[model samples]
Target chain A: MEPLLKVENIEKTYDGKKVLNGISFEMEKGNTKVIIGPSGTGKSTLLRCVNRLSEPEMGKVILDGQVVLDKTVEKEPRIDLNAIRSQVGMVFQNFNLFTHLSVLGNVTLGLTQVKGMKRKDAVERAMIEIDRVGLADKKDAYPALLSGGQQQRVSIARALAMDPKVILFDEPTSALDPELIGEVLQVMIKLAKEGMTMLCVTHEIGFARSVADEIIFLDEGKVLAHEPPEQLFSNNSSARIRTFLKKISELYGGE
Target chain B: METSSGLMIIWESWPMFLSGTITAVQLCILFLGVGVVVAVPVSLSQIYGGKSLKFSASVFEQVFRGLPALVLLFLFYFGLAELDVSPLVAATLAMGLRSAAYQSQIFRGAILSIDSGQMVAARSIGMSRIRAIKCVILPQAIRLAIPPWSNEFANMIKDTSYVFVVGIIELMRQGRYVVAGSFGNALLVYSVIALIYLFLTYCGLFLMGRLSKKLAIPGFASAGAAMERI
Candidate 1:
C-alpha cells in the first residue's frame, strides 16, 4: 500500500548553510514514527517542512494523497494552508498556550473557529478532551496556573481537540522536569495504544523504544538508520548507530 | 476692601464662567473621543501592517508627534481658513490628528510587548490573519495598552489648552476672557483655571487606574502595579 505521508528528497538551506540535504522518509497510517538525532541535526526543520511552516527549498511533501508542498501544481499555493494545518496537529517543546485564555478556551478555540462548531458543542467537546488528559479540574485555569506537565498535556489536548489525522510532537517533554516527563510520556503511550498516527522527534530513548513502530535515526540532515526497536537496539547495523546507542546508554542508562 | 470691583465681577459674570466651564468640559470629552476613535485603527495598521505601510505610518507618527500642538492648530485654523473650514473643525482635526500619532506609539509598544507566540498559536489553530488579529491579538493588545493610553488621554486634556490659540473658547480661552476683565488680578484668574484643570486630570487618572487594574492579567500584576505607582 502507498504510504500515508511521503517526503521525496527534501532539501533546505538557510543563509548558505544546508539544513536538510536530500532527506527522504515515509510513514504508514496509524504508525508511530520516532525520529532521533543530536541537537542541531535539522530534525525540527524536517518536521516543520512537512507542515510547510519552514518551506523546503526543493522537495515534495504528499500527505494523504494531496500534494501539500511541491514545485509543480501551482494554482494559488497559499490555498488550503489552514485546512492542512488543522488536519495535522502539532505540539511544541514549549507548550505555546495563549496565556490570556483559559485552558478550556485554548482547547475550544480551534474547534469553534476552524471546525465551525457552536460554542456550547465546542465547549462540551473540549471538556471531554480535557478529561482525557486528566485536566478536567483545571479547565478554567490559565496556562500560568498549570504545571509544565499539565501545560504540555493541555497542549496535547488542544491539538487532539481538532481530531487531526496525524499529530506531530517536537520534543514535547524536553522542557519538563524529570518527574513531570512521565505524565506526558504516559499520555503519548495511551495515544499509541489507541493507534493514533504520530511523528515524534524526541530525546527520550526509552519512550521511543517502547512506543515507536519504526525508529529513524538521523544525523547531519541524513537518515543514519531505520529499524524496529528490538532489532535497532539489540543489533549493530552501522558503526554510527552503535556509537550513538552506546553514548545514549551511558548518558541515560538503557536496560 | 478694594471697592466691590471683585465682588461685582463675580456676581455679574458668574453665569458666563459657569457656561464656559461646561463648554470646556464638553470640548475635552469631544477631543478625547475623536482621538480614541482615530488612534485604534491607526495603531493596528502601524504594528501589524506590512513593511511599507509601517514605514509610512512611522513617518506620519513622527511628523505629528514632533510638531507643537499650538503650531498645528495655527496651521489648521489660520492656514485652512482660506479653504473655508471653521475654527471648531480645524481644532478638532489638529488635536485629534496629533493625539493619533502619540496614541499609535503607545499602542504599538503595548502590542509589541505581547508574546509573538500568541499570534503563532492563533494561526496554528486555523484562524485567518484578519480573524486572528481581530479576535485574539487586538483584545489583549488593547488591554495591555490601557496605562499608556491613559497617559495619552491625560496629555490630550492638557493639550486642549492649545485650542485657545485658534480662539475656540475652551478653558484656556475662557481664562483669558476672565483675565482680560480682571486686568490686574491675572494671577488669581489663572490660579482658578489651573485648579479646574487639576480636577479634570485627577478624575481621569482615577478612572483609568481602576480600568487598568481590571484589565491587567494576574501574572502581570507586578508590572501593572509598577505603572500605577509611576
Candidate 2:
C-alpha cells in the first residue's frame, strides 16, 4: 500500500542559517508519528514546510499521492495551495481559535467558507466533530470564554470538521496547564485509535509511548532516529536519543 | 445684564437651530459611512496589498491627513464649484475623504494588534488570505477599533462645523446667525451654542461607549487602540 504522505529531502534556511537540512520521512494511512525535539530544532519548521505555511527553499511534500508542495512545481501549479492546506489540518501550540467566533462558528467556518457546504449542513457536521471532542456543550461559547484545553479541543473539532487526510499538531498541549493536558491528549489518543493519520510535535513522553506507532527524533534539522516506540525507548538506542528521552521523562514525568 | 434677551433670541431661533442640528447629524452619518467604506479597503491595501498598492494608500493617507479641513472644504467647494458640485456635496466629500485617511490608520493598527497566530490558524484551515482577513481578522479588528473609532466620530462632529466657511448653515453657522442678529447677548448665545455642540458630541460618545461594551471580547483589549489613547 502506498504511503498517505511522503516528505523528501526538505531543506529550509532563515537568514542564511540552515534550519532543516535534507530531512525525509513518510507516513502510511492510519499511522501516528510523534516528532520529539528540543527547542528551535526545526520540528515546527518541518511541519510548516509540509503544508507550505513557511515556504521551504527546497523540498517535495506529497500527500495522498498528490504533490502538495514542490520547489520544482513552480511556473503553473496544478493544485491550489489553499486546496492542499484545506486537506491538511493543523493545531497550534497556542490553540489559535478565532476569538470572535463561537466554538460552533469556529468549527463551521472552514466547512461553509472553504468547502462551500450549506450553513445547515456545516453546523450539523461541525456539531458531530465538536461532540467527538466532548465539546458539545461549549459550542456556543467563544474562545475567550473557554479554558485552554477546551479551546484546543474546539480547534481540534474545527480541524476535524474539515475531514482532513492528515492532521499536523504543533505542540498542541504546550500552552495548557498540566491538569488540562490530559483532556487534549485523551482526544488525540482517541483520534489515533480511530486510525487518523497524525504528525505531532510534542514533548509528551508518556503519550508518545502509548499512542505513537513510531517516534521520529529530529535534531539540528536532521532526522536522527525513526523507529517504533518500543525500540526508541529501549536501551539499544543511540546515546543522543536515549539521553534526550531520559531528560524529558524526568522533566515532564512529574506533570 | 443682557441674559434674558440672549435667551429670547435663542428661543425664537430654536426651529432654525433644530433644523441645523438635523443637517449636521445627516452630514456626520454620510461622511462616517463613506469614511468606513473607504477605510476598509485602504487599510487592507496597506496591510496586505502589493508594494504599489501600499505606496498609493500611504500617499493618499498622507495627502488627506496633512491638508487642513478648511482647505479641503475650500478646495472641494470653491475650487471645484466649476464642476457643478453643490456646497453640501463638496463639503461632505472633503470631510469624508479626510476621515477615511484617519479611519484607515485606526483600522490598520487594530488589525495589526491581533495575534499573528489568528491569521496562521485561519490559513491552516484552508482560508485564502483574503478570506481569512474578511472572516477572521476584520471581525476581531472591528471590535477592537470601536473605542478609537468613536473618538473619530466625535472629532468628525466638531469638524462638520468647519463647513460654515463654505456657506453651509450647520450648527456653528446657525449659532453665528443668532449671535449676529442679537446685541449685547453674545455671551449667552455662544454659551448655548457651545452647549449644543457638547450635547451632540456627548451623544456620539455615549452611543459608542454602549457599542464598545456590547461587543467587547472579554479580556481582549485592542493593544494598538489602548496605546493610541495615550
Candidate 2 per-residue C-alpha lDDT over A95-125 given as tens digits, one digit per residue, 9 for 90 to 100: 9988888899999999999999999999999
TM-scores for all predictions = 0.91, 0.95
Rounded to one decimal, what is candidate 1's iRMSD? 1.6
lDDT of 1 by residue, A87-199 (tens): 88888888888767889988998998889999999999999899999999999987877899999999999999999878889999889988999999999999988988999
Model 1 ranges with Cα > 4 A deviation: A72-78, A249-255, B2-26, B220-230
Best by lDDT, which number? 2
User: How well does chain B match by TM-score in each candidate?
Assistant: 0.88, 0.93
For model 2 the TM-score comes to: 0.95
Best by TM-score: 2
TM-score of 1: 0.91
CA lDDT, every model vs. true structure: 0.82, 0.90
Listed for every candidate in order, the interface RMSD values in angstroms are 1.6, 1.2
